[model samples]
Target: MRTAYSVETVRGAERELMGRLPEGALMQRAAAGLAVACGELLGRVYGSRVVLLVGSGDNGGDALYAGARLARRGAGVVAVLLSPERAHQGGLAALRAAGGRVSDDALRDIGRADLVVDGIVGIGGRGGLRPEAAQLARAAWESARVVAVDLPSGVDADSGEVHGDAVRADATVTFGAYKPGLLIDPARERAGALRLVDIGLTLPEDAEMEALQHADVADLLPRPVPESDKYRRGVVGVVAGSARYPGAAVLAVAGALRGGAGAVRYVGPAAEAVLAHFPETLVHPGPPDKAGRVQAWVIGPGIGEEADALEEVLAAEVPVLVDADGLRFLSPQRTRERTAETLLTPHAGEAAALLGRGREEVEAARLASVRELAAQYGATVLLKGSTTLVAEADGPVRVNPTGTSWLATAGSGDVLSGVTGSLLAAGLPARDAGSVGAYLHGLAARRAAGPAGAPILASEVAAHLDAAWRDVTD
Candidate 1:
């Protein structure tokens, strides 16, 4: 797992580490790492024209010290002090001693530079950039490949929100540890490629956010033993579809069949459509409880307004995953009353409706919205979007790293709900079920999209799950 800490947590870790080192030692360590990363990006550091957009913080000092290293290696290094009066005195003196000059013609020099370093702001920065800083950020972005110190300027280090006018780096050299903003978007989009330089800071084990690698996903995936039987592996009950949306039942069942569950028992009005698509499914009409004993129930995907079955499924002692129209019937009291685990999967519009907030508000503060929903409902919540987030009431939120733009096609959410529900049936915890399910679902979309990245149907995403599972496990 690739974990990220909050700004406050990172500050605490940095302070602890700095206390153990000599007076300028921590900055020197950071400067040394930053210079190496910058040098590698520059390829031939000798004779390369480098410009540093120096701010007033320690971020500026890192750039200045790094600039000195570049200057010592025969690179023409120039520091454009955004705040001349407050720039690090020691760093400035070091640069001057190494034959690097402080230039006032920032824009003119930036345009001709081979590489530009962004130290305009650090991870501690919030809101939009100041006017002068914003101008320099734009100049650096348009003029050359920008390398950011710690994090891109003006991006929220905690929530991953980007205000107006921020620096766009070709690469970001983050010191000590990864921050939450670096893994999420629209701030994540601004942070190009990421490189972490360990400065010997010990953060808490329970980080604020995390992204799983293939190894993590592989560890979470359920595997059947030779002694396993149909009931032993797990049975997932799916309650979905209506006359107007029969295809949703088929898609959900398609995803469930490949989710490592022993069998799929589907209860809905679209029994004929589901049977036609997946003959292996145990199909039934009417209430979900009568559909037979199930370890977990997945309710609501194109169920329309008929919420009669939603209430019955929620009453079941088994773990339940509520999604699509099923989410409409959920109440905080109803969810909290249940003893079993409950997972709510909602896209932005559904989440907005549930929270009584505008879609724009939820989209703008995705991290906050998802966390709020999880606590309010007292259930695990997976907020679906370009960057899918799985947040429980507490603990680190898992950000899914694998996905493609092609997943925007219709019926993908239904597939995701079914996949997650199957994992719940297979005995994974709600958080693990949600995270691993999303990891596989997104990887399935990437497999379906192929190298061409052609547009694909939701069924294609479901069809590719086996390949995605192998890609992870193998």
Candidate 2:
């Protein structure tokens, strides 16, 4: 798993590490890593034009020291000190000694530079950049491939929130540990490709957010034993679709069949369409109460305002997953009374409705929104977007790293709901089910989208779930 720490934790770790090292040891380590990354980006460091946007803190010192290293290697390096008087004196002396010079024409020099290093406003910076800094950032962006020091300037390091102008880098080379902003969206969008340089700092066991890697997913995945029969593997009951949109039932069944369920019992008005597509599905009419026994239930996905199905599934003694139109009928009082596990899947718009907030608010503050929804509804909540986040009332939030922009198609959520519900039925806890389901769903989407990543249909994504499952297990 790739873990992300908060700003406070990173600062605390840095301080603790610094206390045990020599005065300049930590900075030297950081500068060494920074210089190596810059050299790799430039390919040929000798004779290459490198511009450093030097600010007033240790971040600026890092850039200056790295510039000195590059200059000694025969690269023509220039540092545009945003704060001349406050620039690291030791770093400035070292740079001058190595043939690096401070420049006043930052824009002109930046325009022609092969690589630009952004060390302006470190991880502590908030809101937008100053006018001069913003102008320099823009110029660097237009001129060359910009690399951010710790994080892209002007973005909230903790919340991943960008209020106004922020430096958008081609790549970000973060040190020690990953920041929360580098994983979450909005700010994550500004951070292009992320590369972490280990300077050897010990972080806490618990991170603010965690993204599941392929190995992590492999461990969490459930496999059947030889003694396990169809009933022992667990059965998932799907309550979805209506006469209006029968395809929703077919799509939901498609996801459930490959979701590690022993069998899928589908109960709804679209029995005909589901049976036609997936003949193995055991179909029933009307409410979920008369659908016979099922280990878990997945409700709503084109069921319109079907309050009856929602109530029946909630009344069940097993885990239940509510999605799409079902989220509308879900109330705090109704969910709070349930003894069984409940998982709510909502997109930004649906999540906003549940929280009684605007869509923009939920999308902007996804971490907070997911946590609040999990707390308010007293259930596991999955917020779907560019980054799929799964949060429960108590555990650390799981961020999915395997998504593509092509996953924004319609009927995708229905497929996800079915897959997660099946996992829940297979005896995984709500949190694990949600996390594993999202990880597999994203991997399946990426695979289905192919190498070029052309637009793919929702059915294509569902069809590739078997390949995605094998990819993880193998």
List ranges where model 1 is wrong by over 4 Å.
none
Stretches of candidate 2 exceeding 4 Å from the true structure: none
lDDT for each of the candidates? 0.92, 0.90
Deviation in angstroms for 357 in model 1?
0.8
RMSD to truth, every model: 1.3, 1.2
How does model 1 fare in lDDT? 0.92
Q: lDDT per residue, candidate 1, 109-222, as tens digits? A: 999899999988888898988999999889888889999999999999999888777889999999988999998888888889999998889988899999999999999999
Backbone N/Cα/C clashes per model: 0, 0
